[model samples]
Target: MAANILLTRIDNRLVHGQVGVTWTKSLGANLILVANDDAAGDELQQKLMSTTADSSGAGIRFFTLEKTIKIISRAADRQHIFIVVKTPADARTLVEGGVPIKEINVGNMHFAQGKTEVTKKVYADAKDKDDLLALANSGVKIYIQDYPGDKQYPITDDLLSKVE
Candidate 1:
């Protein structure tokens, strides 16, 4: 049984103030799942993010990519889950692993050495572009939105081409 997935977001910062409070309340999600291998293994990150979610009155859990695939696939219908992953590649893995992600919010990719600016809040490197293109090809509706009230920019081929 698939869980009642409220939102699937790609934010490099994972669970932060905006996501833990604003998005949680807006979506009415009861649980926040941080699906990142690094956060899963780092107790400090887990603790910090857990604190953020707790403040928003949402249950929080950290899981590796594989574990996330397994758990989310079998999640109970009553579980209103909000999944947060760090990268487009991770989101692609979840979708390919049968997590039933239909649409994805590209929240924040952040600027990095090899990345090109896609939007004010989104930056993508070659690998990120490839992974995101793969997801789009697979029928995932990908868009960029920083907050709940922000404008959504759909990731089109024109947008991707402009990155280079």
Candidate 2:
């Protein structure tokens, strides 16, 4: 059917306070789909996501990247979905898997051991930068927006150069 996927975001802290309360309401999303292999397999992580709860009263589901890609076409027909993955690589995977992702928001990707800080809240390693570049090349509008009212910074070659 018609594509109902609204916003696909890459946030390391998936379904947290900002996402649970702010983005769901802003996007008018009825479903929050968390596509992450680690969180999908861990009951504790799932439970934590639930405990945070979508203050906007949206439904939340967690699935592995493969399962999410497989079911996305069918799921889109059912609701306005907001898909969140932990990394740019996962977002790239979804796009490559034929999910009609029009745009992707890079949100909070906290400091990691090997990742270099690209933006205020975003950090990227070599692979992350590569995946982001791939998505941009594929014609997806890539933006760096941490919160609802934050100014969106478009992903460009100049921005990509800052990844180092």
Candidate 3:
């Protein structure tokens, strides 16, 4: 059986205050899954994120792309999972690998070289745009909303064009 995935968010800062506290509380999620390849392989990061999750009264797990694809389907129905990935590409990989993601919340893709600003909180580069477009083509509802209380802006072709 598939896990009850409450939310799939793209935030470079995964499992931080906003995610571990606000999102979990709002969604009533019992588990926060940081499905990022980098975080999954780092022990110190895992420890720190675990501390944050504990403080929020939610369990947390870090998993690589492959591991997430393999294990997420096994999560019990009672596990209300809030998944966070670092980039749109990572989100696409999860969906392609059969993670059952139907929608994606585009959160923080902080400014970096080669990336264009899509929103004050979101920036995207060539590869990011391609991945996002691919996800949209595959029938995923992509939108931008930093916090739980913020307004959601749907990712339309016009918005993607602005990033170009």
Scored against the true structure, residue 3 in model 3 reaches a CA lDDT of 76
lDDT of 1 at 100: 84
Candidate achieving higher TM-score, 1 or 2: 1
What is candidate 1's lDDT per residue for 1-164, written digit by digit as tens? Answer: 65788889999999999999899888899999899999999999998898899888999989999998887767878788899999999999999998888889999999999899999889998889888888888998888999898888888777888555
Over 46-73, each residue of candidate 3 has an lDDT whose tens digit, in order, gives: 9888888998899998999999999888
lDDT of model number 3: 0.90
Score every model by TM-score.
0.96, 0.94, 0.96
Candidate 1 TM-score versus the reference: 0.96
Candidates 1 and 2 compared by lDDT, better number: 1
Residue-pair clashes, model 2: 0
Residue pairs clashing in model 3 are none
lDDT: worst 10-residue window of model 3: 155-164
Over 4 Å off, model 3: none
For candidate 2, give the lDDT of residue 124. Answer: 82
Q: What tens digits encode model 2's per-residue C-alpha lDDT throughout 6-67?
A: 88989988988888778888998888889999999999888878766556788889999999
Global fold similarity of model 3 (TM-score): 0.96
The order of the candidates by TM-score, greatest first, is 3, 1, 2
2 versus 3: better TM-score goes to: 3
